[model samples]
Target: MRTLSGDLIAHRLSQAPAGALSKRLYDVLQTAIQQGAIATGSRLPASRDLAQELCVSRNTVLAAYEQLQSEGYLQTRTGSGTYVCEQLPETAPQASLSPSTSSAPFNHIRLSRRGTRVLARSGAGAYQWGAFMPGVPDVSHMPHDIWRKIQLRLSRRMPVEALSYSNHGGCLQLQQALAEYLRVSRSLNCAPEQILITAGTHQALDLVAKMLCDPGEGAWIEEPGYWGFRNVLAVNGVELLPTPVDDEGMLLPDLASFSQLQRPPVLICVTPSHQYPLGSVMSLQRRQQLLALAKSAGSWVIEDDYDGEFRFGESPVPALQGLSADAPVIYLGTFSKTLYPGLRLSYMVMPKPLAARMKMAHSELYRGGNGLAQLTLAEFIREGHYAAHVRRMRQLYSRRRAALVKVISDSLGPAFLSQQGNAGLHLILSLPERIDDVALAAELEQKGVLTRPLSAYYIQGTQRRGLLLGYACVEEQNMAETFAPVLHCLQRRLSPA
Candidate 1:
């Protein structure tokens, strides 16, 4: 408990005019307790005496003190003066529970104990690499003013019911909008009935895994794939059968290399449009073959189209879902890369039977996706803002990709083989036999150039020596300046012997 005159409280309250005097006083005292400025058992002044000292009415002091007492910030026993509460220190937003492993099965946030190093931008760090961060969209490019206005306008005008927990599937309007968008862009043949809104592609992947995989069962995850898939699958106890990927993409024969589980493989996780880490796009012939293999093996293909929208060179490739007319293919895509990461909106195109299955699954955990954000995004796509954004981003990403390629080629000088798919934000720089790719990535990080080693994405072995460098987040005008440091890294990695 702490003693303070009403005059002292008045001086403290004047700092935050937006907040009430009582609230400000309570906050000041609360922070003092948190910082250990006021130790336990300190006594506060009597209301009447504090009022008299400050020349304020007794009622004002009483009301402020009384509010604090009721809220458990202060304690007042019969005939006892006010004292600070002995409970936990106060905070605006109470800290979330420490990731408890024993409380519940699903209460944990699963992350890999191996090779799961995210770059500075995604982690807790100060200096930024300008704006070039992987898996991040330029939020500054988003129509924020228009979106805020829409949110405000909608909140004021819409019926209260419209703002409540929406339809389990998603908003009808959004589903309709997505159905239309998918048809045009990805060549996905489905109506609003087949689409389900998820927190993002990560959620979509988790849900599919939950519905599809039994513990200790097998799932084919592409080698040199996204680390997110590994984290999600490991958390669910799905035994990952790491299928190796060459230039052609996921090798069917190499997947047969791993020991089979009790259950047959349930899913084949892939990034067909652009393989993660390696940045190799799966060929159309291979896509058909992979679907046929999945069909024969009685497994589903989980298409992780994380960056389906940003493709350059030729026309955008049709998704594997489009190829799988009869086969069971769960198509996953996200607006996180297309929009901003904070939006946390992704969708899935499921087969009818699986859609019914997920309905039951989401019923248990996921109540529903964000309604207002979904609704506004639906409008954005329907009115063609999304398409325009993708087109603009494609051009920008292409330039950055080219810049990365040129710099790496010049710096490495014949060690690099420029791969084909000039579509996405990232590209792979092939390494020679002598240098370990992982060590090279660490070396680059020391020089203040962040790049992901392709080996981190691999499970068992047979990963090519390479590094995945993202340029989509980099500014076109600043590519030369940004690539300068990276060029030095390439020189160091490419040095003789």
Candidate 2:
């Protein structure tokens, strides 16, 4: 809060390399004003005081002040001191605000081809939490007290080493805990050394794409797949071949049909547990077929089991990575859906051979940290809290899902067909062929009922006209109230015009 003085300012200005006195003074004042060292509306020292302090002639200081005023870096008040201008002048150079350009504006700078594609396919919504907002877990039901107790205990007693950078993969405790958990729960065959912890599944996919596939390499993605996967692969310059999904999961083309591709895919990403948005569990036969195909083609399968722990009634489908001993499957899982998104913890179980390379790359690319959280989570899993919480959420989500389904049936009737999927946090409500899912979703969103358009998930081919309604975050008691707007929107839209 100390006020800047004439002597101090003049001394600092004197440090500049030898140059014209007036020009140097002008440049220093201009820089100070631009960088906010001289705050806007701040009264500068009088020209006489600054001149005396710097031992410069009064005329030299006056000339510098006048030049600054002309450049709009200062505002002069007759009988008062000059003040830093609140705003830059119209003619002022915009070098700091924009990239260097002689005749064009910043907007003229072209985006990379991948950037353009990503922008065109951008599906990120501003709103995240609301009725039917897809992929969001009910954080309200989280065991905050238990989690806080663990966090507090760890914070107070954690070793100094736990506060520093973690191993290239992750904290050994967390990795071991995750490996065991995956082994028992998801049937993933992984050791602690094979696991590479990531910020989230998005980062996990990015690493896989970067390490396994090169730019422009053929990569197969499910047609109606997770947009995050699509965008990440696209940004990495992967030539994405949109493989269609069927009732059992991603449909693998016969070897004969596969041979027609200009280049075979080096990697294939699948949401095998509960195929995202659509919620179809990949059948064991299809899982075997995919593993075999990937093996035959010498490709890698990225198995993303994002919400596999939330199955309502059916027995949990074990991850595809566990099917074969040497299956080239990179198993990916995240705590975002299981716990909370803000925790930002996910992991990938890499094949042992690739583990060392991925670890090196992961460390170089994303230096691992967040040891405290990882340790806390490791304890959470080891102590059985994570499984217990998943079990509780599974029941809660089931009731909420049932409530939503009932509301849709009672309000919209048979016109809207809800896909029967007992796993995952969301369900796809297929609409009548004539109704536009996007328009309906927009109307619903305006009315406070959030839903994702099914067509947006498709990269190409005939897109299904449906709405993905997530029920995990909505309580059973509020289901009717939350869905009321959806009913009204549908009634207005589906009514004869």
Candidate 3:
């Protein structure tokens, strides 16, 4: 074992640039021990002598010694001096275990089958906010002051129970508030007991999948649908059946096409009010047919009413869940698109029969707890601030959407536009089938314009080629300038090919 004398320690301390003397000494000593310069079980100098040699205060040396001791790097004897630990905390476990128990190298490590699928099918993006980024709301205008005040007030006197894992479905106040809000705004018929708070649509989807589906079960989703729904079900081992969508929303898949499946679909995921990306409302006829199909097949219909509040001119479409007194639909709604994405608050109104079980499972699995935020939102809704904010954003988004449409039409002919629904935060820009939309989106991203390619949403079918362009967070006045580069790029791409 090497003897770490006061002079040797002072010399090591001098090699580092001056900063906090105690921290510098700690680092130098740690490096020395880790590198075996001061070998295991070596005795360290007395704190006072080391301080005198290094010209640091005695307290500084004591602090460094104490920190190292606390971290298991060094230990002090009752009468003797500080000595290096015989074994480091980091290496002791490995030293005790056999070679067979060693962890595999990074390249040799393997992910579970489910984990691999989850990673492979992820749809998340690097940048969430900027020009034409889809599915994001204008968080700048959210009533932050009001929300902050409510949060602060609640946090000051938050119950000990509120901080614990929420096993009672969710905060009752928010559930009751959502029950009333959904009834009035979206024509959703639900009781507070039937509503379960979730992290977001994905969690709600995950809950529905785990509860209603078994591994390898069949699920029907809209072709060119929200990638989130597909990825969630895919990771859970559900076989995806991409059903086609027209101007009237999700169409029934031909029974012959599903010959491989042993039985009917376990879940039918639909963005019924305003179809995601496409922005088509499911026709009344289609909605009835879907309900009938789900009932006969014993399948659950997941109605994702995301952004249904943002309809431009029309009264927002009634949610499919309210069509009947006992509809077999699970109504999913999110604050992400309306209030803001970071809120991470969304809900699902389960069928009367499934509500109790789903809620219990949700609490067990997710251990939901955001009482302060939940109560704050409850207060926001109760005070009518939520409604007022939605109305204001609807008007703002309408103007922005119009500005985006005009610029795109003026630069590239009106033929480029598709699914110009008078609702939702985004509009689809159609490209020729032959054009590589993923490649086009990548080029636009390079030019600082963010967009999602329509083709990527498809599971396996006739894929649509387009870009989903969002204008909600973007201001109307800056719309033309922000999208100018995209128009220039499209002009060149469309000219020859």
- Report lDDT (Cα) of residue 253, candidate 2: 77
Can you tell me which runs of candidate 3 are displaced by over 4 Å? 1-106, 253-262
Candidates' lDDT values, in order?
Answer: 0.71, 0.84, 0.85
Candidate 1's displacement at residue 394, Å, is 1.0
* Model 3: per-residue Cα lDDT over 256-308, one tens digit each: 54444568888898998889878899999989888887776778889998889
TM-score for candidate 1, residues paired by index: 0.74
Model 1 lDDT on a 0 to 1 scale: 0.71
RMSD of each: 10.0, 6.4, 9.3
Clashes found in each candidate (C-alpha, N, C closer than 3 A): 2, 0, 0
Per-residue CA lDDT of model 2 for 358-461, tens digit only, reads 98888889888898899899999999999999999889999998888888888777546545678788888887777788888988887777899888888785
Cα misplacement distance, residue 268 of candidate 1 (Å): 0.9
Flag the better candidate by lDDT, 2 or 3.
Answer: 3
Alpha-carbon lDDT of model 2: 0.84
> Which segments of candidate 2 are over 4 A away from where they belong?
1-109, 256-262
Model 2: how far residue 36 lies from native, Å: 12
Error of 2 at 34 (Å): 15
lDDT of 1 at 33: 49
Task: Kindly report which residue stretches of model 1 are placed more than 4 angstroms away from their true locations once superposed.
Answer: 1-132, 253-263, 443-448
